[model samples]
Target: MTPFLTAYLQRIGWTQTPDVSLETLRGLHLHHNGAIPFENIDVILPHEIDLSDEGIFQKLVVARRGGYCFEQNGLFERVLKEVGFTVRSLLGRVIIADPPDMPPRTHRILLIQLAGEPWIADVGFGGQSLTAPIRLQEGIEQATPHGLYRLQRNGDDWILQFRHHERWQSMYQFEMGQQYQADFVMGNFHTAHWPTSHFRHHLLMSRHLPDGVKQTLTNFHFTQWQHGQVQESQTFADVAALYEALQTRFGLGVSDARHGFSLQQLEAVMAGFAQHDEKA
Candidate 1:
């Protein structure tokens, strides 16, 4: 096994190299979600999102900080490759925000073919990330630890939907065209630099917890939910409170000193969310 793979396994709390199988894939997906969080703090911290393998390793495993799609799945893709999984990178358009038009394909998704059966596995997608590998088929509600999800055909494309509020809501859509590292580079740049990209404005972070519980931070609001019901919710009144949640709940810290993320910058940006929450 490669050094990167060994370190990655340790980071995700795995003791030994897992065999290349569906069960291993599912375990890694769930453990990755629990150990490393989904966060867009780099974009909010005003640092460029680095998509290189070494850069991803340093930020995620070495620094022990969470990241958005590119960093999160980029690191996972390498680990899977090292463990002998036939993984393919794919791009998807995120429609969870219900944007007026079909937005750019900014989301980095993964497609794995194990024993001729296709499975979609993702440890990214903040808050609503897939907790296990879902079948890449149409019209069937695949039950995961978190909830039920289904994929539907949209012309020649496919859209992933999940059960919520007694309704299936669209999360993302994509065709089967395979993606490459360059595609993620472009997507990461757009996600970080695009002025209107939500990553620049919102402090989005999430992690899957024990027994169907999910923890998320959207701007200044923090929520803990279990099986689609809110168990606890709080809106931070100050950056100190928000910082506490990020550290204690999500396990992120100021580990990447070169990234220059600090409490002061956090306060400067999250001030907007604090004001917005007060008005709402």
Candidate 2:
């Protein structure tokens, strides 16, 4: 096996044949969602998100770390291609607010064709990420481990919705327009460094637990979700508690030593943000 393919499968905990069938696609998607978390610590720490395949592999696989949409979907796109699947990258606008607003195309997703049928595969959206690939059937509620998700046709665009609080809530929208690599590069730059970007201001981490529970840690607060609603929640008392939650809840390691931010430094930096929060 090629080094990249081997490491990619190992990272996602996939031990099956690398085929382009629907079963293989579902397995890859589900395994990836369960294994790699969605996090933005690099952006919070002011570290630039490298979009290169080698950079992503080294950081996420070799260093045992996680990343945001661009990094996660970027790496996933390459893996799908290496496994003989025809994959194309697409962009989407997050519209979670009350009044639906079309933000910049900041999210990355994949469109894969198998046996002349198209499916949407995404394992990157932190809180509302789909745990399995959904066919391109509009208005169909597809059951997944987390919850039911559907795609609604909105004029020329398609709105992705997740079942939350027993209601269908809009997550994002995308068109079939061909997206280029430059679009993702620009989006990543804005998301990583823009002053008002949430990734720049907060520490967010998420992992879909094997027990059908979704665990999320944002700043000092940790929340668990099951069947589309919050089941339990807590706020860490201190940086130490937050560190423990990081290791236990999200399965993040102590630190990315290659980035020069040791665990102590991480605690100090997070403390700085907490103090700033109080002052604000």
The TM-score leader among the candidates is 1
Top lDDT: which candidate number?
Answer: 1
TM-score of each: 0.95, 0.93
What is candidate 1's CA lDDT for residue 275?
77
Each prediction's whole-model lDDT (CA): 0.86, 0.84
Model 2 TM-score is: 0.93
Cα lDDT of model 2 by residue, 7-104, tens digit: 88988788887887888888888888878889988887767878888888888777778888898888888989998999999998878774445688
lDDT string, candidate 1, 1-280, tens digits: 7788888888888775598888899888888998899988888767777788888898889888889888888888888888898997788999998999999989988889899988898889888899999998999999988989999999999899999888999999987886878888998999899998888877898999646889988888889999888999987878988887888888886747765367887888877777777788
Q: What is the lDDT of residue 66 in candidate 2?
A: 84
lDDT of 2: 0.84
Candidate 1 local accuracy as lDDT?
Answer: 0.86
